[model samples]
Target: MDYDGILNRKPFSTAKDEKKLMYGEWLTELTDYHRKHCHSYGQLLKHLMIPEHSHMGEEEIPMLPVGLFKDMDLISIPGNKVFKTMTSSGTKGQTVSRIYLDRDTANYQQRALANIGGDFWGEERLPLLVLDSPDVLKNRNLFSARGAGILGFSIFSSRICYGLDQDMNLDTERIQQFLDRYTGKRILIFGFTYIIWKYFYQALAKSVQKLDLSEGILIHGGGFKKLEDQSVSAHEFKERIREVSSIKEIHNYYGMAEQTGSIYMECPKGHLHASLYSDIITRRGKDFSVCSHGEKGIIQVLSPLALSYPGHSILTEDEGIILGEDDCPCGRLGKYFKVLGRIHQAEIRGCSDTYDG
Candidate 1:
């Protein structure tokens, strides 16, 4: 599928009424496609098949989280295109987002994000300092998220600052020295969440040491799971990022290696909203079914552009809510949802465990 084309073919966001129609049509198509190709999901369609039902239903497909990845390889592409494979960072033998692509598929993901990133920054391209390295851009076997998923999305620009440290440590000297040499440059510093919090935040905050960076933006996607033990709330984490970089905008987005082009970013209003290519609904939640604003529930992501994998209409483990379904005062249009936490095994959705999904 021309994944990027599917996303940018039309205007992404729409009025609430229009979005409903759009989502309905998308869900129908996704369900039909999954029913045809996904072997395990096909079994689900048969089991949940209803009499007189000629089309796919929104609630019929059996939702499987990362647990399923431990058992089998869920892929739709030919084996020859399997550029690389990855593993779930959870317990051993867990499910991971298996990524495969040719140059077009790879470039599609990058162009989509770059278009959006360019739209947000109001620039054709910004100098990006990747928290990882050019190794991620190499052809050798590495984690797909590192090699293709993250780095691939960043290929639209040529001004890329790379990390040379093998230990993944943010070399303060390397970064500052580069910034000092290349002043008055607009940069987009990208990194995993806790990776920045662990390595860069304190160092930057140590006296509010501002670099010569003229205009820099931060886009981090590495989930907070790595720092689950470090005790950092999303707000405090952003605050820390602001405290260190002093950048007005620091977007903590939520995305997976599976769904290549669809991702949700935290708006300036502090709510993470679904992108145009994706939709999120709360099926069940605490105290009641979280069906509206201020209601927290399990987040189910629906991405129409997920033609490469089975993440088309995935119900993730993250617990979230549809904060609002309209244009925010912040001016971002689309569905808004905040990720409260993840739903852990055997734990009730509202049991108040620290992290589950």
Candidate 2:
């Protein structure tokens, strides 16, 4: 598939009315394309008995459990053409998903990020403040989810500073220096949710100093289980951060290494909305059928961006509800939903056992 034309367009530019038909055609083509090129994926589809030329709507498109990536090297591209392999941050002793990408796919991922990042941070690059230690990026080749996230968004800024010390403490002196140097300029801050809450916000909250970052934009994501375990809700997370840092513009996104560039960003109204690069469908736990708005179920993510691998359609282990469509109070023209955290006992499997026929 030629991604040049698709990547050139701004992210989330498609209207909701047009998406059904547009994505319907695109996803159908991609499914057949992957089936023909990926031998293992073809076998899996046969096992599921999805008939050839099935005319089901986008929601019925066959999806592999996201855990399949950890079990097998699922790729559609030739081995020689593969340019990069992205691994998920599985827990200790757990196997991780290895996502393969050719030159085109990798470039497309960057372009998608650029478009979406521009939408959130504006076109101009800002002084970037990373909440992790610098050592995370030193390896250059392998990446945990945290490391890849830092590197992926680094393209938007020339000046980068790590906000954490080697011991993972809040380096107040370093952050103060960054603020002083970029005074009156818009800043971009990136970090995982729990890390920001524990290391950055808590540390700063305990300090006597007040830092005003009201003009800055903070983009954070990753699993929120850690925070929930500590009794920290998203609302409280935002409130505490604002109380400490004075940073008002914050967006928490939902994304995975499996579908690198397709990020569902939380709008100002606090709903995560999908973009043109991807779409989300909630499935009932009982029958794997699509759920209605305001209904909670497993989240099935679909994206055309995973051309190098069979990650186009994936049944993730997260639960969520489709709150609304085309009518987000934020005025974004797509489906907006809420994540209710990961399914219990879902992470223990190197590969998820659940399957959608």
Candidate 3:
């Protein structure tokens, strides 16, 4: 299906009613497409008794549990057509989720991400300073979430520099050179949350050197389980980052490997804003019923970008609460929410914290 109509729309421009109509048609089509192409998914729909061509509201759509990808090869495309396989980060001996992407789906992901990032960072491509080592991308065929994140966001950068060495140590000299080269210019910095806190922020805190990134915008995601253990709140993370570098703007996004590009980015108001490409709904654990605004429940992420797999609507292990819709003080039009971390005792599978590399 052609996605130009939806992709062309401004990231957060569509209001709730219009977005519901637009996304409803596209997502319903995607549901039928996946049910026909993927045998396992077809059986799942059959078992759930959701008839073919059924037009259901966003919350009424069937959501495959996110963990299913860890146990099954849930690709809708033929094997030969697979362009890339993305794996979620996990500790040693833990099974990771595998997300298959065909060329078209992958392209859509890139385009969608570019559109969303453009809305926030502007159209100009700036110099990018990645917080991880370049070696993480050595295995191009299969990517961990961290690797894919770096590659995906690299589109916003005119020149890219790796701030960490091969051993995951902060390469201060390399970072300094990168800063010097882009002095007095706005640059982009990307990294996983825990990695930035442990390697970049803490490492810088130990040294007498203080780098200047007053003109930089930092985008970070991947769960905060580790930092939470250290009692590091989001506010603290931003304040500490300022102590290390003069970077002023920091955004904490929420996304998973299952649905990569259509991330929920945090607005200036500290709420995670869902873009036009995706939507968010919270469900009570006891019955999976939709939750009202300000009520915390399991987060169900809905996106139409996962054409290569049955991942369009997924019941994530994470918990969150819908703060508001179409009325954020930031003026973005869409549902804004706050992630309340993973469900109790859910496997610790955030990109940075789980990645042993």
Q: Name the top TM-score candidate.
A: 3
Clashing pairs in 1: 342-356, 342-357, 343-356, 343-357, 344-356
Candidate ordering by lDDT (highest first)? 3, 2, 1
Residue 191's lDDT within candidate 2 is: 85
Task: Give per-residue CA lDDT, model 1, range 1-357, as digits (tens).
Answer: 445445564334566666666666666665666567667666755786632225444444345554454455666566776655543334333334455554454455555666566556654666677766455455555454545445654654557667446655556677776677557766777876755665567556675455544367777775676565578777788776775666666887777666666667777787776656666777674532436667677776666665544566666677776777776766777877777667765222211111121
Candidate 3 residues lying further than 4 Å off, grouped into runs, are none
- Report the error of model 3 at residue 189, Å: 0.4
User: In candidate 2, which residue pairs clash?
Assistant: none
| Number of colliding residue pairs in each model | 5, 0, 0
Q: For residues 187-232, what per-residue lDDT tens digits would candidate 2 score against the true structure?
A: 9999888778778898887889877888789999885777777898
Off by over 4 Å in 1: 1-5, 9-12, 50-53, 56-62, 83-88, 91-95, 101-108, 133-142, 203-214, 226-228, 285-290, 346-357
1-357 per-residue lDDT for model 3 (tens digits): 668877887999998998887667778888999999999999999999999998877777899998899999999999999999999878778898999999989988899999989989998999999998898899998999889999999999999999999898999899999999888999999999998998899999999999999999999998788898999999999999998998999999988889989998888889899999899989999999999999999999999889999899999998999999999999999999998888995877666635465
Q: Residue 92 error for model 1, in Å?
A: 6.3
Candidate 2 vs candidate 3: the TM-score winner is 3
Q: What is the lDDT of residue 213 in candidate 2?
A: 80
Name the top lDDT candidate: 3
